[model samples]
Target chain A: MRIKGYVFTLFFVLGVIQDSVDGRPLLLSLSRPHPDSAADFARWLVSQNSWGVLNTIASDLGGAPFGNVVSYSDGLPNKGSGIPYFYLTTLDPTASNALKDQRSSFTISEYPIGTCGKTDPENPTCAKITLTGKLKLLDGNSDEVEYARTALFSKHPEMKDWPKGHNFQIFKLEIEDIFMINWFGGPKPLTVKEYLHIEMNKVAFVV
Target chain B: MRIKGYVFTLFFVLGVIQDSVDGRPLLLSLSRPHPDSAADFARWLVSQNSWGVLNTIASDLGGAPFGNVVSYSDGLPNKGSGIPYFYLTTLDPTASNALKDQRSSFTISEYPIGTCGKTDPENPTCAKITLTGKLKLLDGNSDEVEYARTALFSKHPEMKDWPKGHNFQIFKLEIEDIFMINWFGGPKPLTVKEYLHIEMNKVAFVV
Candidate 1:
């Protein structure tokens, strides 16, 4: 009986490890909101993804649109405030390009979250959102900078240990226009006001 | 003896499945070349990833750079040909935006390939590449279109079934500049010629 108990426990631990590898935690598996709930769905997509492509006008490349992979956060987990915050260093072209031309956009995909299942990343049902706005650097001394840091560090624990000599600083996209495609039919008509004002209650989360 | 054999076979099957999930096929786990081999490294990155952010100038949004999630292919599996090909539809902003302004870039991250392991997506060590140049629509009748279709369908099988009314077409990035950061210092100094011409022998693959 003692030997059998030991074997059972070993299999149980192995099963848990496999589940984590193939499945997201229960909290993350919450069913996606209906596509008609554009505002809520868009915000949920932003809150769940950890990274995206940050685009900027590259003056060096003769004004070509440049996209770079970056990590960002809106708030702590489910408490997203609908604003995407970033940590950038001027050593990269994205920051320099933004300084030269503030016009930019940040895009995230629901495909990475594993909720898209077997759908192609380009499938409208998989969902993709682009937040078009100016990329602005936050004042180092501002209170928002403190909050942004906490939010970023909480999601990406490794950021705090990134090289200080690189001079990484806080940046945020002041979203003016929202473009999202979550389902069939053309882009959904979602106003910036509707997207920003979506109440947290509308976004259901499985306990 | 029969019961013990049945238990052994069950464990063997479970182990095989777990290994398949954790280890990419022997072909993909081929070790990454030294970052110094610029062209080989760039081609490897493009061939290994199935999707990326395709950026285009959104003229309607005050010329802000808009990045959208897209699936792409360089060629058929191990025969990648150094150029990234995409299937796009004008119904989507990325395609329409490209038609209005050819200036664009395609960005891909190594993080999705599962090779980044514990490294943060934004960590310089976790490779990222952006190919900046023109987003040109290919002539539907061209021979390259046939090649592009085969390359794309082989990787993203579901794409072949995407809505036909959407008028999906082939587009390719005419890469003029390569910005890749696979290691700490900064973007590697790689000219388009060097990035396009490196011989395949330089990139080693594990058997």
Candidate 2:
């Protein structure tokens, strides 16, 4: 009785802390799709995650693959576009690299999503997805840029207050291939067409 | 004092949950190094994080960069070598890609380490690092392999119980260049030699 009250209070406090720390509220409402539902699972992974390693070719380093930590959004909450958009500046190597080569990949892990309970991050049961494609910078005047900005700012409110002198612009990964491993059988057979078209009805509302 | 008792009990329960989910004890002891201490900060980020995205060139996908979620360790707790070691299998594309081309990079984020407080993961204050180097697979008979396996299994206990036929091997990133942004000034200028040679005496105990 009293113990239950304490537990609830604790969780509430922890929830608030997590929300503030992560810059968005905890994803409590959306249920994880079964591993067999590859398209849904892939889309859910992208939409649920706030940040991932965005890989680009570093021409200065003899064209080695360079992965940079960056925040991204597919859309606003449940309204995901299945395409990741970023707010980047030329001051960073990731944006600079993309301008020269454009070949890139973005990787997200289910580990940080707080769902892979007691599972080793490398364990095949833990979900991970990589969207491989050309990283294209969006035009300043495009309607897509407007939609992407809303998506980015809603998730990361501090982004709106960033330094104007940095010349932050929108860049998105034009996914050409998908690589995901959620179960023991190996990489799931998923295509870009399938991933982009899957209806996210099962994801529920974002809390 | 009743409120204090409830808060304590709640935190105790949550700590257990976080430890199990992360597959290691919560890092509540060690203090974060100042961002100006680039070498210490970089080493601390690598040592504390258990998982990251390792990027490689996907030969099958026209040599586009491929990033995969992976588990890694620098050394046994508090005895870090400042070099990232990974347990990889050829079944995964990261290991397969590394074999074809050793040019790769491993990225780690301080966000997962839970010390960034309310900072956004992409914010400069929330440090991130990319170690551009060759991902070399160690020989089976090498003494270094023995050290690496100890480093890996200590942090991730379930690796020992993994399926025997999977044939997981040890791999290390021979870091040549370091790109880290821990504060407002942009990427810190750090070299591989300085990063490896820095004394980790300030990190304190593992608990």
Candidate 3:
């Protein structure tokens, strides 16, 4: 128990320190850049005004992919790539049914509306970048619970009136995967390889 | 094989017809909307912007949810109810690696930039949405490959010479499960039930 307590304390400290990095994933499955590069990516995200799509694996029903959309709040840690945080409220029977059947994955994609010919509104091309993570529904306020909520709302003020109940569940996603799309071409398609090495270079993600 | 095709085609036809009403699952998951709700939802998606997050579950893979930001050019067979229908290119090693390890769940969420608050240059709240589906990679069209080159420029224009080889590797997501975010409040969070009800009442999606 003592060792556990010590470990808990260490984790707590690490979580707080992690705040310094914002909500960016502490451990990404890919390459990590220098602190400067990390900072560059974070600043770019805010400046770009990019929205995030998060992907997670739901619990299950036979074998199929279940997914949901939730908005991401990038301001929590404030450093940019800090922690990828967001808030979502659902009352749909379909979502509830899916949730009941299995956990869901969220894909948060950010894009530059103007740059990708999305400026006209009549015909828009959106450039996208995605983050991959795992989400767990939270019970009540505990250590991680509070952190998640605080981090979420700090960035998205619109979520201020959402209720707190078993109905208004909170999901926590452990960051895992990250990808960005090079969508400069309007309808013309690009390969996954070109996507990574070419168009995506502008986004300065944690590559 | 012919008989099996016939049966599958029958199911396909029935599903296409019942899209909006029943939310039928099909090979191209984001193929279309339920007949009844097709027009309304299509209008909504256009008004709300077709660019949103799609949350999906790889029911086969422990209900893993995946979210991808996709470009939607509906007017296809069944393109309403906001079912995703498009192409995506991902070269991220992590994403490819993840696919090798497991199937994925995906989701896409959409939010109006200024719906909740004011969106200005300094204070920007980006509009969002997603396409959640099973993922796989593919190459770009031979004729249009050059323009699709990301090596030219991260932005829309080109910088220098184009890269060689198959421009795109490929990442195609056949969607099965999905949900869109209905965020109109602050921190309190809206329940999916309420959101879905609003969507249903506002429009008729059932075939």
Candidate 4:
């Protein structure tokens, strides 16, 4: 019970930070980068559990987004937990259909990084992030898939139960482009690096 | 010479296969996302010095589109090869200025996913992917910055040379929104299960 409270507290503080940052007027950082901050988010990711949704956008097919739950095996021998990758096997047909169409992009969003519940029903944990990239069906035999799966299983052993069948094939998500909304609220967009790594995990203070 | 030519030819053929599966028509393979016709491309990626380029969009302070080069670190602890992570660093004041001015977005074309030519234009390999996402200064201790760096660097040893400075903070191209262009060319996309415990060192026939 106490652990739950602590988790709740962490989320609350996180909200405050996001709101404060988003509330401020927008400013560019790189125009030179602050390597320190980038590293911050990455480390945080290394420290926690990675659960998120894998999404793809085939606007040509439909305007609605395609989403799925994914569990990551983050502890690959060489990759950082901060840069965790996942192996997904969904029975949903949306993914398979997308591949057949040979579309141009897919959007992946992280379920709100922190205490993912409703503070604002309309935008609750909509700290949703979308990554745009060219989707490629990896050759079932290549080492990439093996690496991807190994990376995923290292973190999540439960994934071994993944469904398999006649039409079953595995595809990988190669990130191409990215966008992130404020962890706070409004249009305080963020960079993908900020949310994915350690920042999301360590995001203890909000507003 | 023959080896390099073999590598280059292999690269183009892979590109075509990548285009067919990702850029062409959409195929649905959720639950079991087995992307079709993406095999050749994956093999090609492995064969080509283990790094490739992803042409993507970066949103500038003004909300305009710009191109940015994405350096892929396919080789993990052995960074010279293996499924590398794409990277980009911002040390230019102009980039910081632009980010400070506008919260931007970047679109990435995942083709040759490796280090781009230097932004300065003098270096032959100096490719610059566009920049997006507003940049911010690290807090005094900059817990965030530290976190991100370790996550990425621990995996990509070459990351040690990544741009770093006192006031300068380095960050990565975290993708948010993405799409792909596909047309079946060589190998197909990998299946979900094979992703675990896999090795990615295969080369498909080149065009």
CA lDDT, every prediction? 0.81, 0.84, 0.36, 0.33
Ranking 2 against 4 by TM-score, winner: 2
lDDT of 4 by residue, A56-133 (tens): 432332322333333443444223433435443333333554464323232222222222222221121223333444
- Model 2: per-residue Cα lDDT over A1-207, one tens digit each: 698766643432331112222434444434566687788789878987899999999999988999999999998876788999999999999999999999999999988877687688899899999999999999999999999999999988999999999999999999999999999999999999999997654334434
Q: Which residue ranges in model 1 land beyond 4 Å of their true spot?
A: A1-31, A201-207, B1-29, B199-207
TM-score of candidate 3 versus the correct structure, residues matched by position: 0.45
What are the per-candidate TM-scores when only chain A is compared? 0.85, 0.86, 0.47, 0.50
lDDT of 1 by residue, A32-69 (tens): 55677788788878887789999999998999999999
What is each candidate's DockQ, to 2 decimals? 0.41, 0.46, 0.19, 0.01
Which parts of model 3 are misplaced by more than 4 Å? A1-39, A42-51, A58-62, A74-81, A88-106, A112-128, A137-139, A164-166, A180-207, B1-39, B46-64, B76-85, B88-207
Candidate 3 per-residue lDDT over residues A1-207, each given as its tens digit: 797656543432231111111122332211221122223332333323434544433344334344433445433433333344445445533234434543434343334222222331112223344444455566575776677666566655545554555255556544444333333333223232332232223322232
lDDT tens string, model 2, B1-207? 797656543432232112222434545434566677688778878877889999999999888999999999999876689989999989889999999999999999998777676788999999999999999999988999999999999988889888789899999999989999999989999989999997665434434
User: Model 2 segments beyond 4 Å from truth?
Assistant: A1-28, A201-203, B1-25, B201-203
DockQ order of candidates, top first: 2, 1, 3, 4
Q: What is the lDDT of residue A60 in candidate 1?
A: 88
- Docking quality of model 4: it rates as incorrect
lDDT of 4 by residue, B1-207 (tens): 797666554443342322111122322110111223233333223323222222222334222122222233333222122222333434432244334443322322222222221111111122112112332333435654555455445543554653344233443333232222122231233432332123442323323
Report how far residue B132 has shifted in candidate 2, in Å: 0.6
What are the TM-scores, per candidate, against the unseen true structure?
Answer: 0.85, 0.88, 0.45, 0.32
